[model samples]
Every structure is written in structure tokens, then in C-alpha cells.
Target: MKLLLDENLSHRLVGLLAAEFPDSAHPRQLGLRGASDQTIWDYAREHGFAIVSKDNDFRQRVFVEGPPPKVIWLSIGNAGTSAIAALLRSHAPEIRAFARSAQEGLLVIEKAPL
Candidate 1:
């Protein structure tokens, strides 16, 4: 699934996770740095991207609005980029399944196994 990495994530993650998340991109790469959450939400909806973020704002938005574009909420706080990448890689299958599902709106990835 294509992911629009929120500004809170390192832009380098785009490259780091590219093999698995082909065509994934960050806001800064799309001239969307500093854009409001709603703006990013709209862009992801428009572009068929699953929004990957550490921000709770997006999670709350999904809870309220439901999904046109799904959300993968990274709950791993204060982790390094490599740790983030590894977490994502470890959960890749689940994330892809979540993306494909019509019923589920949010997938939260925590620091420890859940």
C-alpha cells in the first residue's frame, strides 16, 4: 500500500521502507510540509494512500470520519527511525491486510507486542 508519511516521521523513512512500501512518500516530498492534518487527510484520500502516522489527531479523525483512505497509527513513541522501520517491517503483513479490509478503519502499532 502506498503510504503518505506524516510530517512527524523522518523523511528518510520514505527511502528506508521503500522496498516494502513502494511509492510511499512524505509530506515534504510532496510540498505538503506544515500542511494541516485535514489538508493531508484530503490529499491521502484523493491519492489512494494509507496515512501512516504517529499522530493521534489522525486516529481521532478516523474514529469520527471513518475511512476513504485507511489509517495505520504508529503508537511507538520516541523510537529511532530504524526501530520504526523494523516495527513496520515486522507488521507489514497485518498492515497490508488492514489496508485491504473494508470494515476496519484503524490499525495501531504499539512498542511492544499486543
Candidate 2:
């Protein structure tokens, strides 16, 4: 499944994770920088992207509105973009499974405690 990196996430992640998540997009690249969450959510639903975000807003929305556009909530606080990329890569299988699941709307990913 493709990912649409949220504003809170570094846009560079799209390129960094491209090998695994092809065609992923970033709000800046889409001219959606500073756009509202509703607008971003609508875009993802129309284009079939799982929203990847460090913020909790999208996670909250997914629970209340369920699928079409799923959410991959990154719970890694104040992390660098590389760390975020590594976390996602390590969880690629689970992320794909979550995207394919018909009933689940949210996937909360956090750094494995050191």
C-alpha cells in the first residue's frame, strides 16, 4: 500500500522509503502543505493511500470514521526522519497486512524500547 506522509513527517521520507512503498507522497510535494486534516484525509481516501503521521489527530479520525483511507500512526516521539524510516521498514510486513485488512483502520507503530 502507498503512504501519504503527513505534514508532521519530513517530506524526505517519501524518497527514503520508496523502495518499499512505491508512489508514496508528501503533503509538500502535493501542494497540500498546511492543508487541513479533513482535506488530507479526503485525498487519501480518493487515492487509496495509508496516511503516515507522527501526530495523533489522524489516528483519532481513523477510529471514528474507519477505512477507505487507513492510518499508520507513528508514535515515536521527536524522532529523526531516518529513525522513522527504519521503524517502518522493520514493520513492512505488518504494515502491508494492516493495509490489506478489511476491518482494521489504524496501525500504531512505536519504537521498540531500548
Candidate 3:
């Protein structure tokens, strides 16, 4: 599953979680650092990348429209890289399942432990 990490997330996350998410990329790396939400959404749709973001805007957009590229909305509170990684570790199975299934929607990840 390719993830297009939104600008709200630190670009460092790309390297930190590279092993787990091989095809992942941050907006900065793709020269899309300051792009608008519409641009980001267009890019993800074009490139077949499911967006991973802390922004709630995408969630609303997804509900109104549908998903061409699915979204992993990190609705959790502010956290360090380690905490985010831990969350991903615990939810790896669910993530994989969601990525593979044709069901396109937002995956809201909460702050508390699973």
C-alpha cells in the first residue's frame, strides 16, 4: 500500500517508517510541501496513493465524495514519532486489510491504545 504522507506530518516520518511502509512518501519529498488540499488529493488520485494525514478535512471530503485513493486519518492527539509508530504496529493488520479491500473510506486512528 502506497501512502502519501500529508504536509501536516513531519517528513522525517518517511524515513522512520520506511521499512514498514515501503512505498510511502511525504509531500515535501514529492515537492508538494505547500500545495493545497485539492492539489494533494488530485496527486494522490493520479498516483494511486492512499493519503495518510492528521488533517480532518480529508475525512469530510471523503464522506461527501468517495475515495479514489483511500485515507488513513490520524485523528489521534499530538504525538511523537514513536507513539505513531506504536499505533501503526498495533493496527498493522487492520491497515493491511483496509488497504487491500475495495472498501474506500477514512480510517480514523485514535490517540488511546488499542
Candidate 4:
């Protein structure tokens, strides 16, 4: 699935994700710097991208709007690029399943394994 990495995430993370999800992109790369949450959400919906973000605002919006372009809301806190990459790599299968699954809600990736 295509992904739109939020501005809160490192642009480098996009390149890392490219190894597994080649079609992913960052808002900065897309020239969407400082865009509002709704703008990001609308763009993702229009372009068929699943958003990956640390912000809960996006998750709230999703709950209010349901899914058209799904979301993988990263609930993790203060993580570095490597941490993000490791999580994605280790949980690639689960992530892929969530991306495909018909769950119309936020998918939270916690800061630490529970």
C-alpha cells in the first residue's frame, strides 16, 4: 500500500520505508510543507495513500470520517529513525495484514512492546 509519512517523521524514514514500501512518500517531498492536518488527510484520500503519523489528531479525524484511504497511526513516542525502521521491519507482516484488513479505525503502533 502507498504511504504518506507525516512531517513529524524524519524524511530519512521515508527512504528506509522505501526498502519495503517503495511507493511511500513524505509530505516535504510532495511539497506539502506546513500543510494542515485536513489537507494531509484529503491528499492521502485522493491519492490512495495510507498515512503514517505520530500525531493523534489524524487518528481522531479517521474515527470521525471512517476509512477511504486507511491509516497506520504511529502512537509511538519520541522514536528515532532507526527505531521506526526496526519496528516496520520486524512487524512488516502484521502491518501488511492491517493495511489489507477491513478495519475502519486507527491502528496504533505503541512506543514499546507490551
Candidate 5:
């Protein structure tokens, strides 16, 4: 699934994760630098993107709103961009599986298995 990186993430991550998650984009690159959560949600739903973030807001939305635009919430705290990218790349297969899964809307990834 294509990823819509939240503004909370570094815009540099777009290029960093491109090898595994091609076509992934960041809100900053899409003229959505300061867009509201609702607008980002609407955009991801309209297009085909799974929102990846460290924020709890989107994850909470999934419990109430379900998927069309899936969510990959990075539970790792205060990590750098490369480390975050590595975490995502290491779980590429699982992420792809999550993309195809019918019932799951949220995929939380932390440094330690949780």
C-alpha cells in the first residue's frame, strides 16, 4: 500500500522508504503541510494510501471509522528518520499483508514486539 506520511514525519522519509514502499508520499509534498487531520483522512481515503504516523489520532479514528485508507502507527518513540525507515522496511512483507487483510484497519509497529 502506498503510504501517506503525516507532517509529523520528516519529508526526507519519502525518498528513504521509496525502495520498499514505492509511490509513498508526505503531506508536505502534496500541498498538505498544514492540512487538518480530516482533510488528510479524506485525501488518503479518496486516493489509495495507508497513513503512517507516530500519532495516536489516526489510530483512534480507525476504531471509530474503519478502513479504506489503512493506518500504520509507529509506536517507537523519539526515533530518527533512518531508524524509522528501517523499521518499516524490515516489516515490508507484513505491511503488504496488512494492506490486503479485510478486517484490520490498524497496524502498530514498535521497536520491541508488543
Candidate 6:
């Protein structure tokens, strides 16, 4: 599944995680840097990209509007970009499963305790 990484996430993540999440992109790459959440939401929907973000707004939107572009909400607070990438890489299988499912709208990914 293609992921549209939110502006809050490191744009480098698109390249860092490309092996696993090929075709993933950042807003800056799409000329969407500083774009509003609604614009990002609409872009993801139109482009068939699942939204990946640390923001709760997208999660809230999913609850209220349901899915066409699914959301992967990273709940790992204050983590480094590498840590975030690791978390996403480890959960790649689950993320793919969620994307393929018809009933799921949001997937909340939390950091596992050390």
C-alpha cells in the first residue's frame, strides 16, 4: 500500500522506508508542504494513498467520515525519525493487512516498551 506521509513526519521517511513501503511519498515531494490537513486528506483519497501521521486529526476524521484513504496513526510520542521508521518497518505486515481489510479505518501504532 502506498503511504502519504504527513508533514509532521520526517520527509526522509519516504526514502528510508521505501524498500518496504514503495511508492510512499511526503507532502513536500508532492508540493504539499504546509498544506492543510483537509487538503492532504483529499489528496490521499484521490491518489489512493493511505495516510500516515502522528496527528490525531486524521484519526478523528477517519472515525467521523470512515475510510477511502485509510489512516495509520503513530501514537509514539517524542520519538526520533529512525525510531519511527523502525516501528513502521516492524509493523509492515500488520499495516498491509489493515489496508486490505474492508472494515478497518484506522490503525494506531504505539511504541513498544523497552
Winning candidate number (lDDT):
6
Which residue runs of candidate 5 sit more than 4 Å off their true CA positions? Answer: none
Candidate 4: segments with Cα more than 4 A from true spot: none
lDDT of 5 by residue, 3-99 (tens): 9998999999999988898999999889998999999999999999999989999999988999978999999999999999899999999999999
Q: Which lDDT value does model 2 have at 93?
A: 99
The TM-scores, one per candidate, come to 0.96, 0.97, 0.91, 0.91, 0.96, 0.98
Query: How far is 19's C-alpha from truth in model 2 (Å)?
Result: 0.3
- Evaluation by TM-score, superior candidate among 1 and 4: 1
Q: Which stretches of candidate 6 lie over 4 Å from their true place?
A: none
Those runs of model 2 whose alpha carbons end farther than 4 Å from true positions after fitting are: none
What is the TM-score of candidate 6? Answer: 0.98
Give the higher-lDDT candidate: 3 or 5.
Answer: 5
Q: Candidate 4 — which pairs collide?
A: none
Model 2 per-residue lDDT tens digits across residues 1-114: 999999988999999999999999998999999999999999999999999998889999988898879999998998999999999999999999998899899999988998
Q: Which stretches of candidate 3 lie over 4 Å from their true place?
A: none
Report the poorest 10 consecutive residues by lDDT, candidate 4: 104-113
* Model 1 lDDT tens row, 7-113: 99999999999999999999999999999999999999999999999989999999999997789999887999999999999999998899889999899999885
lDDT of 1: 0.93
What are the lDDT figures for the candidates, one per model?
Answer: 0.93, 0.93, 0.83, 0.83, 0.93, 0.95
The stretch of ten residues in a row with the least summed lDDT in candidate 5 is 105-114
Give residue 60's error in model 2 in angstroms: 0.6
Task: Give a tens-digit lDDT track for model 3, residues 1-113.
Answer: 78888888888777777777777898898999899999999999999888888888887788877897788988777888778877776777788888887875778888786
